[model samples]
Target: MSIFISKEAKDKAQGYWFGLLIPLLAGWGVSTFSMAALMSRDGPVSEMTYVDYFFITGWISGGLVVHPLCAWWVLLRAKIVGNAPCIKGAYMSIKLYILWIFFLLSMTIISFIWGE
Candidate 1:
């Protein structure tokens, strides 16, 4: 097989990788740092402890709690707009929100099983 890769394929791969990587890292960083801070007294905890628990809780909270709240806010905004023309952005947001809900639900189930 040829080793050459097209620029479009390379870009698509990078986009997929970064899209997945950035969210995971963002969730991990937010969860880990926040947990560490709360768990600490003198100062922010420097080392990660109970990493798996933090990651699981972070993803769970982000997907279930945060995502729904954001979706609500979007819906509220749409309501305020009151019969305005359909915005392209809204369709994209709705798709992303649905995907996130499914992903979060799966993650929740996995975490529950794993926890047991």
Candidate 2:
């Protein structure tokens, strides 16, 4: 409502440990699974046994950081992905939702126009 990142998003960004715990755990789970699969594919690495997992953890953290930023971006662009301040919500909304569709559309258009 106000520029970008409403009170809700701010709440999420500044959310309690429990709020962040979900994102962190979501990050951990996705990272762990992806790491296992990728490491299995790449065979073994003497350099590091769980490097892929580290990568996943990095990615998950990135997602957590990006989620709130994306929320802010939505506000500036008026691209609403309803209740998509979290990973799970964004995943679900991306499949079937006007807010997400609009946001995706805006990004595509912007990419085509700005080459970003």
The backbone clash count of each candidate, in order, is 0, 0
- For candidate 1, the TM-score is 0.36
Q: Weakest 10 consecutive residues, lDDT, candidate 1? A: 83-92
Expressed as tens digits, the lDDT of each residue in 1-116 for candidate 1 is 53438866665554444433444444446656656655653534565458545654764576445544544454455457542222223444456667867897899999999995
Model 1 regions lying over 4 Å from their true place? 1-4, 42-116
What are the Cα lDDT values of the candidates? 0.53, 0.48
Off by over 4 Å in 2: 1-46, 49-54, 79-116
lDDT of 2 by residue, 1-116 (tens): 46536776665543333233443355456556665666566554655557565665655644444444443343333324333334343333233234544786899999999987
Pairs in steric clash, model 1: none
